[model samples]
Structure formats: C-alpha cells, structure tokens
Target: MTLLASLTLASCSTILNNLPGVYSIDIQQGNMIDQSMIDQIRPNMNKRQVLYIMGSPMLTDAFHPNRWDYLYSNQPGGEPRMQKKVSLFFDGDRVIGIQGDFKPSALPVIKESEETTVDLPPRDLEKTMWEKITNLFGIDDIDRSTESDRLTEPGPATSEPTINYPDDSMPR
Candidate 1:
C-alpha cells in the first residue's frame, strides 16, 4: 500500500512539472484621435469654442499658458504604434496658430497664420555603417562596464562628486 501511494505521489509531481506555464493576455484600448473633429476648428474660435469642439487638452504647459497640447497615442498588439499630436498656440484669448500631424494646407484659411518653420540639420552618411554594425551586435560600452569604471581608470580623483549646498544666512 505504501509503495502504491509513493508511486501515485511521484506520478502527480511529474504531471504537474510537465504542465505548461500559466500565461495571461493583456489588451490595452487604442487612444487614436478623430481627425474629422480636429478639421472643424477655425482660427478665430475662442477657448470655450475650441474645448467644445475638440474636448479637453491632453497637456498644458504651466510656463507657457498660451500653448495647449493634445496628444493621442495607441499600440495594437506587437505592431508599430500611431501618435497624433496637436498644439494650439493662443495670443491672449484668441487662437494664433495650429500645428499637428494633419496637413496644414487643407486647414481653413487664416488671415494671419503664425506658423513657425523649423529646419533640422542633414544626417551624415559616413557614420551609418558603424552605427548599423554596433546595433546588430547589441553591444554598448556603457552597459558592459560598471558606472564607476566607464572611461577613466578608478582613482581618488575619479570618485563621484559630493554635493554640498550652503545656507544663505551662514557667513563664508
């Protein structure tokens, strides 16, 4: 009877070990914005009118109260995610400019469009080969070495700096 019980227990253990691991699927809802709603906005529209048309802004900068940013991002499965960002710049209470992923040319004509053009420097093709080789190997000098011994050899002078903030009232 003891032999039979031991064999049964061992069989149960083996079955349990062979069983597939527990896995859970998590599906997150997409946050892409409706482009039709954005197209309806006019240049002369007030804050209340804009809010009523486009809903609440996603991000608001405290330093620059005039700028209202709306961002919508979504990722489906392992596919590449999509992002839509709209920035409305206000001069006092009136909307001055509107910029985003949507085509500006198709937007309603404004009397005084305050659009600012940005020019980015051209990329160098010489370093492309080196960058591709490094990325393929997935090897980074920073990751391979410890924080303390990155570029410089370990010594008293190379030690981490200690921060000391002096009180304003104390005499030097």
Candidate 2:
C-alpha cells in the first residue's frame, strides 16, 4: 500500500509545469535602471550627458522630441517581478525637469582630511621578468653577469642545436 502510494506521487510530480523535459524560461526585457542612475541626473544636464548617465530611453516619440522615457521590467526565474520608469523632459538640447518612479538621493560630500603616508620604500617598477625570476631563485645578491649576459645576448651558438647523427664508424 505504501509502495503503491509512493509510485503514484512520483509519477504526479512530473506533471504539468514540473515535467521532466520542460525547460524553465527566463523572461527579462527592457533597460534595468536603479537608484544610483537616478542620482546621477542633475538639472540642466545636456541630452548627451543624460543619455550617457542613464542608458538609452525605452520610448522616444517622433512628435515629442523633448520628452524621453526610460522603462525597465524584469521577471527572472524564481525571482519577484521588478519595474522602473523614469521620464526626462528636455528643452532643446538641455534637460528641464526629471520626473519618475524613483527619487534622486542627496550625494554625500567627501571631506579631505589630514593626508597620511605609509613611509614605505619606493617600488622598483623597472625590474624585468628574468630579474623577478632570479630574485625568486635567491640569485639577486650575487653578481651573475655571466648568466645574465648569456641570457640576453643572442648568437648563432645559442640559436640552434647541433643534432648528432651516427657516422659510418659505428656498428650498424
């Protein structure tokens, strides 16, 4: 009886929405705007600057060139739905007013306080990869000119290897 019930329930679990071959679809459409984007908007900002701050408007009416609308809607898998709308009113090339579903928060003014220094030694930025490798191998202290010169200087002897082929004198 228990086994029969378990099998029935298992078969029912694969029905409708949770069917085995069904793939859950992600529905995301429109520009995603946030509060930070809204905060960037300032009065009298140029159209180009406003466009750069907020992504391209979702709706632009041909007759109303002065008005631009930004819209966003997202319904991701297993997540709650989200929507944002912002309207920018422009006079000629400049922004006149901004009205939307979001509020622009006051930006925090950073105060420059006393300057502090770490007193650490200046970095040696000129060090090459070979120099770093040599330092890692603990060969930095030694005056390794022969090794260093051999590495940097390119000549015929270093370029190609002489492969030894068996001459006639050897046992065939």
Candidate 3:
C-alpha cells in the first residue's frame, strides 16, 4: 500500500504534465510598418508616394479618403503582445501630417517618384504614449513634438545592390 501510494503520486504529476491544453493561435491583423518605413514619409508627399513607400494602409474609411491608418498587432504564445498605430493625414493628394509611435528624420525631403529608397540623417528618438502624456503634464524632460523632428529627404543612391551572394550552382 505504501509503494502503491508513492507510485500513484509520481504518475499523477506525469499525467498532468502530459495533458495537452487547447492551444490558442497567435493572431496578427493589419499593416506592419517599421520605423524605417515611417522615416520615408515626408511632407508634401502625395498619397501615391506614401503608398509606394510604406505599402497600402490597413484601414481606409469611406468617409475619409485623406486619412490613412497603419495598424499592427501581434500575439505570441506565452509572450507579451505588441500593437502599433500610425495615422497619416493628407491634404488633397499630398501628405500633411503624421501621428503615432514614430516620427520622421531630419534629412532633406526627396520628391523623386522614380527613386524609392534613400538614406536619411538620424534625428530625435520617438516617445511612447505615456511619455507624451507625461510631457503634457510638464513632468517629463523629453519632448517629441516640434518642427525639427520631421523627416528630410532620401539620401544618395548606392551604386551596388546591398545583397550580392556568391554563385552556388547545384550539382545536376
């Protein structure tokens, strides 16, 4: 009876550990825009230009053709999730303003429709929503809203492509 009790106790834990619970799938919805893509945004950039740089926005209201929403959300098993929302305001065809987690750089604004990629000078870092709120209350030292924070232009184009892999012919 003593041996039987110990055996049952040992197997109980193993059984519980082996039991499979329903796995929840991580869901991702909306556009996933990165800081580099947001940095490409420039004042006076038309809707077409914005589309070219960052791809299509996830949310576009029928009533608001001038407003574009870039939303991203991710949930991984046993990990903290993240969400980001970027709103671009356009006046007629040109982009007028922007809002969300990132801000543009200080490089000269490039308007070439042909050239899509450009290097930019680094500028001030972006603040979180909490930081912005704290700033509104005059408690935080960081301030993110200013005319100097806007993005400049695309940098000079590179002569060679960034990726050059060596030849690797498969044995036929």
lDDT of prediction 2 = 0.80
What is candidate 3's CA lDDT for residue 100? 91
Candidate 1 per-residue C-alpha lDDT over 29-112 given as tens digits, one digit per residue, 9 for 90 to 100: 323456666666767778998888777888889999999888887654434666788888898888888888764446564346
| Clash totals for all candidate models | 0, 0, 8
Using all chains and alpha carbons, the TM-scores for the candidates as numbered come to 0.43, 0.50, 0.47
The digit string of per-residue lDDT tens for model 2 on 59-95 reads: 9999998999988888765357878788899999998
lDDT of 3 by residue, 78-163 (tens): 34688999999998999999999888887855545775778999975687678878878989666555655544544558876675
What are the lDDT figures for the candidates, one per model?
A: 0.72, 0.80, 0.81
Decide which is better by lDDT, 1 or 3: 3
Candidate 3, after superposition: displacement of residue 29 in Å? 2.0
Screening candidate 3 with a backbone cut-off below 3 angstroms (N, C-alpha, C), the clashing residue pairs are 105-151, 107-152, 107-153, 108-152, 108-153, 109-152, 109-153, 110-153
Error of 3 at 162 (Å): 72
Error of 3 at 38 (Å): 0.6
